[model samples]
Target chain A: MAEAVDVAGLVDRARDGEPRAVARLISLVERGSTALPEVAAALAPHTGNALVVGITGAPGVGKSTSTNALVRAYRAEGKRVAVIAVDPSSPFSGGALLGDRVRMGDHATDPGVFIRSMATRGHLGGLSWATPQALRVLDAVGFDVVLVETVGVGQSEVEVVALADTTLVLLAPGMGDGIQAAKAGILEIADVFVVNKADRDGADQTARDLKYMISLGRRDRSGPSWRAPVVKTVAARAEGLDRVVAAIDEHRAWMTEHGELAGRRLRRAAAEIEAIAVERVRTRFPAADELAARVVEGELDPFTAAEKLISGSLGE
Target chain B: MAEAVDVAGLVDRARDGEPRAVARLISLVERGSTALPEVAAALAPHTGNALVVGITGAPGVGKSTSTNALVRAYRAEGKRVAVIAVDPSSPFSGGALLGDRVRMGDHATDPGVFIRSMATRGHLGGLSWATPQALRVLDAVGFDVVLVETVGVGQSEVEVVALADTTLVLLAPGMGDGIQAAKAGILEIADVFVVNKADRDGADQTARDLKYMISLGRRDRSGPSWRAPVVKTVAARAEGLDRVVAAIDEHRAWMTEHGELAGRRLRRAAAEIEAIAVERVRTRFPAADELAARVVEGELDPFTAAEKLISGSLGE
Candidate 1:
């Protein structure tokens, strides 16, 4: 059995901006602690004050660099910032690449800035599922802004959008034009597009393509549609980051005004609740192994098997 | 009411290798139709005969070309083959890239080959959830080989491994080295590594890097270790494909001999059954919306809210 930490004490210290306390609280969330109800109660009073921003893009698009730039931008505005990078690397290696990228120049000494790279390899579907709660920890711990960075590879990237006030989709030249971006399903999730590595030769072309794609994909035109603005940035040099921040702020304001923020949070929380409940139900399904054998042997079809498993576990 | 398709008649036609029947059965699976129970009952007896090979990689890795080559290879051996490509493109767009790639000139006329590109963007988490059932339909329809291809952007790609007897992880010369491949979470799922477009520069380097990375990431040393062999292939030109086929066959034989095939199938069935049951539970949780509001308002902790919602729904 894992040792029981003092949830109340941890939350109090975390609220007072103690790094150790904050880290411990986040670890509880990361580990999906059995004491989550107490921890959630302890932290509930302090959340909903921070702005959560999600930064995501395909590999080689400099997502980490953009996140570092965004963090600096938020810090420059005199706001405490926390970074939670969802790394795809294995737990065995601790992901050297993500680590190096997240620990940007001179970030270690900054008391106002906190960075945590959560390993996604700990369990299947672990990091993304854990991230929303971990964000709550940082929010309750007095961070003015929490930046969530994810490698845009999977369903986790989609999940990140539901948890954020603003989602920035990053793309570079030759990764694909805006049409290719649309094909990859990034078009729907992006509140703003960042054409990172804008100093490259095809930067203007990429921007134009994105703008065109955005126009074509504008889902609603009856009301004031949130046009996903494309911002060009040479993130490696920290150029054009101001506009990216500006776009995020604009999107955040729009979401707030249109009540989309509340809707997104409600949906995210509901999804989280459902996920936890389903996991609990799954734990009782020891008979699933035998049921699976029946399906495999053609003794029963999958639906009847599934119905039995659910009824057996949920007592329905 | 979807005008009821004759479930038994479709099964009979599908077993007789009628393309239209196979296509309609797969569509029912892809759509998560109300008739799925009937479909499963009809198709259950015909499954467990086909070999499922999952081909996955990062986008632009020539996965389609490789799949086409594999299909042809299977055809040359007088085996019927089916290609199910989980395309990321939205259904509104009809996935031109996936379509053009899958059409494979002259092979379109060959009824021996069945090609279906499942649109991943139809619904959130749709393709992965639908794939196993679709595989069941194809397997039952008397195909000797089924090549399941995915762009591998997320958790869905990981889910594919549960259904496949052998998983081929594709990489190219310029798309990072083996360490980069491991970072993308492909190392664990890969049964074989194919360096496609191998005529390009750094092909040898990519192969060497993968071999080195595999040696480093060897998770088990006690039992008969399945070392993922790196093969070079210019798939577009159909070069080095014989070696690829040989590797896949060898892996398939090894899995069957080890009883791993039965174990994998049972686990896959259990997972599919679990996913279905969870979805059923989710559909009953209307109180989740109210609970979400309380969590967002900080009036109730999320964990507490989840417990209440689950108990209310499941009568726990």
Candidate 2:
């Protein structure tokens, strides 16, 4: 097993600008195995540098097209970009079609642009259990900007994107489900909105409706300091992408200036760490399976089970 | 405090056809409190009798309208029905709008009809945590049929609907996001498909496309036995609702003949018990919090933590 992987050495190689090492590290994290702890420990010191952006919307809203456009815009500014595409599993085959990679074909040969597609694999969220680790690997590998594109507007997608530094919600004109999106959890998490295919007839109306829906939730006092902007875009043609990039930059700057960026990152990091800890306890303890069986059999309650499990683990 | 709610007594009263007791019992189950073990045990023997039909689609696909039509149809057949309309939490206030109840106003006073509106309440699935409990309560309370209508097409919603004995996916004409729905995990779990708003243009094409997609997934050499019928309805006018109900009845008959109905009900009961068990652990266990804190501190890993927690509980 290669002596359980030299996590520290791999991290060092990745930090030294070795692309293969970086890729390998990400693969390890994505596997989310027992060795993940060592890899995460090694990569932890190098993270907290990349600006993570989340792009999401209903499918066929041209999310990939918009992502490609945004990547091009960032590349034009001489910035290194990493794109993570979360793909859905094939219901028939239970494997990913890898359609997301094909959608972003233009970046296939671009060295400055790195693309990876992930599958949910039965994770409750539209992300893999190892997504956070993969992100850390990407960060340690020195990507200045990271873009996470969720496959669709499911609740898990929204929750996953909420962990990003800036979340951009993409919508197509004439979806007529704008209010539905707002009603669902997507509207609350977006820091910026893009009405892709703005050339369509109802684009203006959709924008107006979205703005109105947003204003309903704007308390004007206790929420975030900035208001989410609705940007119009023709992503395929790359029109209005500069404005999108500019909006993202402005949001980043505002977050940084207002201290919200660091605060949010801290919270996200805390959540990440907490999730990791719970996962570890579950993996290391043999009694966890028995407890689950008891709960399943209705012989023991879940809450009491949880308490006993934790107490035992802490040697109480 | 009211003697801490005599869970067994409440379950008995609900089973004896007391509406107030049924409602209160469902509330307890929905809350997923530490005391749920007692409540679940009391109700376990009384459940596994009702037909659970889950209806889901994007908002404005007329899911509510279709539900109303179905309710009217089933009621006309002298079948006692329970409708559980699961709505999303309001983006502005983090509260449920209860819009589904308003849309279902006609059944407000019908003695044979039970209408309940549930909020997503931060649950990832579109269905509320209390849904299974509510369904069980209804089943035990003597309702022969239960219908669950989810507000949107989310993975959670799909998962919730998948728990139902029959799942009907409502699609509206001219939505233009059918492929997107397919990608978002809607196409796989559908037991029956309804192309609502058949009066609208392009209904035929949409139906054709949906049929083709269904055909793509049918791999069973015995041919799935039950062909998912594509019923076209204009629910606003109560058009073709009879056909929808007929389709549901046909599915029920097929399941009964194949012994699938009993098996499905057994599975649903098991699932309900499993959910209740997990909820109990979550409620009684403080370890989740501790593990979460460790994850935040980067001192542990998530997967391992989850496994450890589960195993520890098993030992209890």
Best by lDDT: 1
DockQ of 2: 0.09
Model 1 chain B: lowest-lDDT 10 consecutive positions = B307-316
Q: Can you write out model 1's per-residue Cα lDDT over A226-282, one digit (the tens) per residue?
A: 899999999889899889888988988898899888888888778777777677657
| Candidate 2 structure quality by residue, lDDT tens digits, A1-316 | 3338878788888887676787787676666545776776666556678889988888799988888899999999998888877766632453343564475478766777777777766442325356777787888678899998888667557556657999998888877555876777667888898999999999999999888888886866695568889999999899999999989999999998998887676666545644554444444456666655554444544444555555554232
| Per-residue alpha-carbon lDDT of candidate 2 for residues B49-102, written as tens digits (9 for 90 to 100) | 678899988778898788888989999989988887776664245334356357
Each candidate's B-chain TM-score, in sequence, is: 0.88, 0.82
- Write one digit per residue (lDDT tens) for candidate 1, span B1-316: 5447789998998888788888889888887888888899887877789999999998899998899889888888999999888877777795744584547574878999988888776753476568888999999989999999987557768777877989999999998898888788888899999999999999999999999989988855678868888999999899988898899989988888889889899988888888777776676577678887877887777777766755564232
Per-model TM-score, in order, reads: 0.64, 0.61
Q: Each candidate's root-mean-square deviation in Å?
A: 8.0, 8.5
- Candidate 1 ranges with C-alpha deviation above 4 Å: A1-35, A38-261, A313-316, B1-3, B56-69, B72-77, B95-111, B150-159, B169-190, B193-220, B229-244, B281-287, B297-301, B304-316
TM-score of 1: 0.64
